[model samples]
Target: MPRMLPPGVGRRLRKGERIVLETHYHKTGRPEKDEGAEVALYFAKEPVEKMLHVHMLANVFLRIPPGSREHKVTASYTVPLDVTAYDVMPHMHLLGRRIAVTATFPDGRVQDLVRIEDWDFAWQETYQFKEPLRLPKGTKLRLEAVYDNSA
Candidate 1:
């Protein structure tokens, strides 16, 4: 289920804008059919002041050999502006073993954002922070994913 934004924060949709839905499907041994996903966009009744955006950190050209125990891939993004991050979602396929996200502030201090020692594709979901985290401009956000492609 998608989360709702707090009051005074909302995303504006332009007329005739395109919306894309990304879905992840898995097989359950038995043959089955997928009925697609249902999405709902709620309009704000009150005034909205903030707009929301999504930044993807991806290494799309990675290749891992079969039977590899611990193949690692990493990606990073530098923050161009100061912003508040409230939710984070990490994605990996079935062979994923672990994943971690960290941020290095401009002052050279590194902070652990999120880490999963054991990663399972079936249990993946968006993680909402207890409070919004402020990321300063020029902060480096790094993501490292480990894969165990052994059968």
Candidate 2:
């Protein structure tokens, strides 16, 4: 079933409550960069407090060749409240082998939100957190995803 939003969710996203999606790619031995990584953050039909799901969309395009060395791609977003389990997953091309998510708080407490070690590019599935992870107010939600670009 589609979710229903509360009174003032959109205003939050538009009013800087929404975190800008960022991408970072690391090349084997060379300097790290954000060459061709793509990141998309989508809100559920309802706000984080109302909906049972938070849709996260991530993608990466490797500018370098496939077989030189493995590369890592990362994407992140932020929510108004400390997030508690709303379907999280990473999206990548045929080179993607693993995806992991980490939520870091302002106090430096880190939580492993989700991890997909042996992901297949052909079959992408929505990852559900075992339990809802709660973040307190004034917390900065950090989600980091890694991708492998290998032949």
Candidate 3:
């Protein structure tokens, strides 16, 4: 996912700075073949006022029955600091059927971040919001994912 820095923060890679990158690939039953992958980086022409941050929402302890058609898993995290959310990414395996992410304010107001009623593993993507979502401290971010494990 790519994001532009919000307007007075300037980020520069210092000399000898170490950057870590991670990638995941699906395995097919066929023999290995040569494949190409690349990552592109863009720099802003001027300085920005706010820095962009990526927050990962994940559920790692998913366990579904062999014939389950609508197994569900939920995870939540509380915001430790005030932040502006600019994008969302939902990740799942082939069994995933639906997913949703939402935010509950401390005052009891609820806001939908993103929702996918029909999830396709092949078309997974990151959705950028038209306008940044302002999340105050103490807001709870909840994620619910549904999966189908039937043969």
Candidate 4:
């Protein structure tokens, strides 16, 4: 788990469900031997009222020309049902400088879910909101990012 959840909240898991873990090993320049690893699973002691789910938003298509700076990338998604979002995580690779996620309600109300004016790929982490947002149906999510391809 990247971050611990608050009490009474946990990842949804059904009875008799088996968790499949995936591991990625990188090649080192020098000779290396395999080391042992382990993972721990913790369940919520209290009844779970809310489940945490991760949804990734990404734009794979890009056409950044050589020596381009401030390249803009955008993507959006609409919610079909009501949801309460308590955490958000925005990711970008090298050359990314800015990113912002916003929500526009049906009634023309706008809310900033997450915004990073100075994006650093090394400082990626989940952001826990102090107050969970009640995103009603028909909420539109918009993501805009700026990348520097000047190199």
Pick the lDDT winner.
1
Candidate 3: which stretches are off by over 4 Å?
Answer: 1-3, 8-12, 18-35
Clashes of each: 0, 0, 5, 0
Error of 3 at 106 (Å): 1.8
lDDT of 3 by residue, 37-123 (tens): 677667777766676656788777778889999999999999999988877889887999999999999899999899999998865
RMSD of each: 2.0, 11.6, 3.3, 3.9
Q: Write the per-residue lDDT of candidate 4 for residues 1-151, one digit (tens) a residue.
A: 4467777778987899998886545557789778956788787888998788776776878667779898999988898888888888887778889999999998899999999999987647678899878889999999999999998
lDDT of each: 0.89, 0.54, 0.83, 0.84
Superposed model 4: Cα runs more than 4 Å off: 14-39
Candidate 1 TM-score, C-alpha based: 0.88
What's the CA RMSD of model 1 in angstroms? 2.0
lDDT of 2 by residue, 25-133 (tens): 3346777654665555546565444434554534344354556445666556655665445455566655666667776676778777667677666545555555545
Error of 2 at 10 (Å): 14
User: Considering lDDT, which of the candidate structures 1 and 3 is the better prediction for this target?
Assistant: 1
State the lDDT at 130 in candidate 4.
Answer: 93
What C-alpha lDDT does candidate 2 achieve relative to the native structure?
Answer: 0.54
lDDT-superior candidate, 2 or 3: 3
Q: Supply candidate 1's per-residue lDDT for 54.
A: 81
Residues 69-145 of candidate 1 have per-residue lDDT tens digits of: 99999999999999989888898988899999999999999988889998988867888888898999999999999
